[model samples]
Target chain A: MLVFHTALMRPPVIDNLQYAKFSPRIFEEMRAGGVDAVHVTVAYHESFREMVLNLEQWNRWFEDHPDLIFRGTCAEDVLRAQQSGRTAIFFGFQNPSPIEDDIGLVEICHQLGVRFMQLTYNNQSLLATGCYEAEDTGLTRMGREVVAEMNRVGMVVDMSHSAERSTLEAIEHSTRPIAITHANPAWWHEALRNKSDTVLRALTEAGGMLGFSIYPHHLRGGSACTLDAFCAMIGEAAQRYGARHLGLGSDLCQDQPDSVVEWMRVGRWTKRIDYGEGSAAAPGFPPMPTWFAGNRDFGVIRQGLLAQGLSEAEVDGLMGGNWHRFYAESFGPA
Target chain B: MLVFHTALMRPPVIDNLQYAKFSPRIFEEMRAGGVDAVHVTVAYHESFREMVLNLEQWNRWFEDHPDLIFRGTCAEDVLRAQQSGRTAIFFGFQNPSPIEDDIGLVEICHQLGVRFMQLTYNNQSLLATGCYEAEDTGLTRMGREVVAEMNRVGMVVDMSHSAERSTLEAIEHSTRPIAITHANPAWWHEALRNKSDTVLRALTEAGGMLGFSIYPHHLRGGSACTLDAFCAMIGEAAQRYGARHLGLGSDLCQDQPDSVVEWMRVGRWTKRIDYGEGSAAAPGFPPMPTWFAGNRDFGVIRQGLLAQGLSEAEVDGLMGGNWHRFYAESFGPA
Candidate 1:
């Protein structure tokens, strides 16, 4: 049977206070986690140019570390990466800022090996509204046009951070299946990051894929989430929307410091990164549980899945099979 | 019963020479023709700016000679012009050159009271393919976007000068009904200015209106066309797509000179104007037919319709009822 790990994050804490510093030990932990592939985002930076530069740097790093890093543009690449015993790193854009106002830039980025593109991150852009926006107006005039263009160009629109109205409009406008690459079920958690059950059902009915994120804040147990509990959450989603439609997306932020965490909390770059005592803790869930233990790694989570009742097949499907299938259906011939 | 002529062109030639020179005789003939409203184009010879200036000049001219000309932007305007015993002159553009690349300019022209705007004018533009273009690639990316925008903003998209592909694409993209506004039947005479029967059927199916033109070049007989011949052509189209879908677009060039005719034929402007020939011709029809002795004006055409076995209801539908309905559906209260 094909064995793949679905959600594996290199760093466990992204919006933490100590985001400025890099940790080489985190990379080693990811390698030991046996994660076949991972979706890495390089978009939500200061500007489009900066995002390009950061992606170029990531590309070079992947090139240097042949054993640890491999770029995956599609499902085939992920499969090949697993066969070759290398971690497939799929490039993603958390927001449409990199595209700016040009609709043609979508094709350009697809050519540049950025596989998954989200219309909006955590704010409104030219394309669509983000989840954080209070007014969830449907797609703008330009936004509808952009959706058609994206469909024509064969790009998978990720609605992980999109506003409700904009998300529904995208779901309606898209001819191909859309993906919520990393989100929780609002039915269970009631978090803004979680999707309502109605929206979730509609998404699956429209031939879309859902990625249940293992973020403690969105789960019933916040930082105290264990591998078994996370698996149970995913299993519930699988039962709700067939196992074929479900996948894992561990929104792990490992190396980031308290400053980065604070920056994310304020929701803008100019604002100070907040890492206060109680503020850092997620509601319901304990303070961000380090991956599985004190270590911010995927190996612990992999072992934790084994500790649960998940068979190897179910674990593999949860790990990456569903994501692989989704990628293949979305981006043809790649 | 309400009666109006569907098409009336101030003959293109008198005694086999281009009617480049304007004569007072033509104005007298128009008065005799009982023409209540004429779709007059100003973009053919001048740039967009020049077209605006020319229309302003004409507006002032109409103000000075209240008995001769009346500005008509709507069905009510036409009705008022007729009730007031003046010839209602509806301003139109044969080509979209005046607005150039700025889409916002469309709204400006709308504000300035341009009632009809064609996508192309016998040549390719930023928005669409013209009939004369070697390849009719349909609406360009911007063109498709513009069509949707036009529909949303409520601009009548005239396709008289547009290529077949561009016309079809516009029809599909526009949620509101489109108007050919001026063209003969390619089936009657396979002229580029004429539309194919398939396109006509599609237009009618979409609740769009077709405004047949009286340009003799598009007719089989060319300069030999008489008032009876024009009615016969209209009768054939009425048979093909019932009387309700048909309307009159006189394409009447009552005052343009021979130099303007030659400039239009060459598809370029001389030192007298800054634009091309395509813009000079009225949208949806061939160059204006030269004046002739036996040819009657708009009023005579109305009488001719009576002689063509059309009942009062059918004649009214063909003359102006259809246009009134189209304008109401397209512009709403405006």
Candidate 2:
């Protein structure tokens, strides 16, 4: 009875944290915070060959840090990580670059354990319009096929950095539920990267998941956002949209230097620096909110949500249970 | 006056022949045939880097056979070749493999002297559906952008191997004239690779070009097709669609080994042999019509067209004059 109770009590906590400044300390932090799984960004602007090199680096990390982390290719891996008291890391691409122009690579990427792939990343891509493109052309010819292939192979279609029309079309076109693995509601933050209420509503209605972002640029008050305010926003979101579709994707960039942010925003595609949602005068990583700074800070968010009047179950879901459920369903062949 | 008359008599001829088993013998035959220009294919299923190696090989050929051939990037190159008593070899692609998924590579291909590109070849591609696919999904989202980019960069959109809907859409979408670089009209042969009269009419009406194919698979009677029969079909095509849109594309696979034919038809897309528009039992290059066995046979076709009641000027246009005019107009930025 005690064994069963302990198993029930240790339900997996997952974060779809888009990108993190990777180091052994970060894995330590994840373990400290009880993070069972995280969908880590493996490709932002990488070509297929470059992405393979990244996979090599990650393989080394898994070998070197076996106690703190393991590569998660499916929901079972998350459960295993929880059982072992370690964090499971799943690969994801913020752009479709790693697949390039070939539809065959979609299956190859799934074989490589890329669990989530955003159709675009802050600029018009071969697949769809990015959030920053002047005009949205929606899902491109290649984009439609790639989405179908991704769906078939069980790679979750992520539209976290895509424009509204493209994201909406992806949702309509994809057979499986898509994800905006990291972003908040535009109504709450008014950031260009944030989703509109229409997108959020349609997304949840279509069985898709939305991972509420904690990036400073996407917050209501940048780095100064209060824990109470952030929890209140999630509470209101739960009221407007069902709590089942809500989860936290903290989007932590802990211990990262400035240049890494530049690479994340403008990889090889541009000779000029594109600060994205941030201004050029301050094109570095913005200061994370004091209330929620790293993996360890997820507890603070859970406590604040409970204080903000969310039920304990609802708080649990927001912290990671929702994502744990989504990961279970999304990370396999449809 | 006699010298001027001699110069006028040697009118330049061009063929969008795709890939001929390129050799010095073929170049000599081209000179014998009075063929001033040929759009030689640089890629079938090759990526950009592999295509670059092909360019390197062609460069070696040009350097070794300078008296016989020169590179052609514009219509003027044809006239220059005519004056120099050499054949002008213009680069083309039978498939969009060289560009891969990067739209930026379109301009790079043009800069490398690629003047023509087919959207697909015997299968569905990133850009459009090939004729062999069960369901033709027309111009893909990427296809539209690629066509626009091709137009802006002055690359002729060839729809020889693409499906009907995709071909029609490409013609409609492309601002400049597109081409059915090689294939007979369906009214002439009814081959799966042949264009329908509807496609032909739409193509010519939109100021697009059609190149009469001499490849046996695309001919009415295969290798047994007679010169008079072939010429008669062109005469009928001229009556229905204006003579201005007609030119020679030959679809010639001269002097190629059977394995090379397999490469052209199957590429790297499939591991299994795909006898495109040919019987699997005889999955090799079909015999060339006895009357049109090599590049040196163009004059026989010209004479046969004249015998079938086309005027000297119409015969001239059919042989190469039309393509020369098209080359002049279409090979520069729109």
Candidate 3:
């Protein structure tokens, strides 16, 4: 049985809209949770040099934790790591900030095993505007060039945090497929982070994939979220976008601090939505737990799928098979 | 029966790109050309206030030449002016530099009866990057918002000097369609001002229109161009893009001083392409001719179409019907 955890987070730089902290223990927790691999992001509000330095740090960390963190550049690598009883860490970036204004950097990052790059974080960058931006200007001229370069270099352009126009423009401009590495549906949440039906259809029509997120702030009702509630959200998305194109992008900000949250709140990083500030934090959701707490464990997520009466095959697809297929198609052979 | 001269240009600003000195006689020349209505572009490289001032000057000019220069805003106005034996002067700006960074100014300009605005000139602005820019970053964040606002305010978004990405992004993002306004396809000549075939197709698909430019430098073999040669370029474009979406946008720079050309050559207002130290000029082209000489005479262009063996309807479409449809759809009523 190919059992893989689709949405696992190895936090240190993962900054949720509300909080940011570093938790080194999450990797161990993921292992205990039966997680085989996780897509780990590198770029986030960092300069080009800082991104390179962080990539170096990640490379060194993989070397230090050979049994724990095996770098997975492709689906085959993930399978191989799982077979060897090691956790596969696929390199990704939540934002294209590291690439900055130079489009050629996309090819460099792709060559360096950075397989997934979200077009924006929570705001506008040189490439694309994030969902939080008051306007979704789609792809910049450099952004269109970046999409072409990514296609040529085989890097996956992620649109988890992108504006609607940016997403549509990217879909139209890209010769290769794309992915929404983590997002919810606006039909359920009406949040900026949620994908609209038009956008979702456009993504799938372009042979892309979607990673339904588990962030509480993007849920319909503020916080008070349980694993079952998260599964219900995924169920609704699955019905609309189909389970085949759906996977989990747990958006788990494992270990981040309060200062990072402040940085996200105020900064000219991207324009803000007109719906008032600090709406990013779910009203009743407690501060993010150290790891997956309460009924938030992966097993609980599986149980929730059972509660939905989904078949074993469907469950398998949502859990990891779909993501594996997506990675293989997008990233090519190991 | 409803004949309109679609490619007519007002005399003053034309001198800037034409390298000919501005003179009062230029307006008489335009009237003698049988141009019933001319798109009078305000200054290209002027500040917002300067553009406003130019408009004021043109308004006064119309007041002075009551029988010759009538203010034209809609197709009906053009017809009315034509019936009254007057040259309808449709006020437009080659670039939105006059709007500066404020989105509200789009409405302000529209209210002031300015109909057309290219997002950028020969450089990057708050809205978009121009074709001449070394790095065509396309529409900036502000550019996307501006497009929506333009759609809302019923203003035409022209991409005459826009970067390829910016052009495509504008076409995709615009709700009420858009126009190339003035550009040649790179297929005819690999000039910076020429759009790619992909771009042309994208614009047509979005129900937008293309305004084929007859600037000699942008045509193959430059200054050696004749009406027949220019028509051949249009014929090829018409074959690919269909005549319904094609209209003439002769970039006739009639009465401009040599200093403006020098400024354009140095890219003083915009950055130069990377391969070249200076702005990309029309290759192998001689110095820009005086206004009427730079463009084929409307009558000669019609003769050229007939000589090219085009049907009467095709010639009519190329001459003005296409442009009439575009204006009617874009500007609405009169």
Best by lDDT, which number? 2
Kindly list the per-residue Cα lDDT of model 2 for residues B1-334, writing each as its tens digit: 0122334646678887658879998999999988889989899999976786687677668757999998898877877888899999999999999888977667667756889999999799999999999999999999999999899879999999999999999989999989999999887788789999999999999999999888888888899999999999999999999998999899888888899988988777778878876677988889988998888888788889999989988888888888988887798977
**iRMSD, per candidate, in listed order:** 19.6, 13.6, 22.6
Candidate 1 residue spans exceeding 4 A from truth: A1-24, A265-287, A290-312, B1-334
Q: What is the lDDT of candidate 2?
A: 0.86
Candidate 2 DockQ category? incorrect
lDDT of 1 by residue, B1-334 (tens): 2233345422111110112122335434545555556566667535654565565565545645767666666666655655565556666677777776756556445544666678887878888998877899998887877676667556788898788988888888888888888787898878888999988988888888888766566666765677777788888888998888887765545456555655564545334542322344442224444433322444555677889999877887676667766665775322
- Give candidate 3 regions above 4 Å deviation: A1-24, A264-291, A294-296, B1-334
How high a TM-score does candidate 1 get?
A: 0.45
**TM-score of model 1's chain A, to 2 decimals?**
0.82
* Ten-residue stretch with the least lDDT total in model 1 chain B: B11-20
Residue-wise C-alpha lDDT for candidate 2, range A240-328, written one tens digit per residue:
98888999887887888898988988788889988887786888899988887788877787789999888988877787778877877
| lDDT score at residue B279, model 3, on the 0-100 scale | 35
Worst 10 residues of 1 chain A by lDDT: A11-20
- lDDT tens readout by residue for model 3, B65-131: 7766666677666567556666666667777777776565665566457778889876787899887
Candidate maximizing TM-score: 2
Q: Report lDDT (Cα) of residue A238, candidate 1.
A: 71
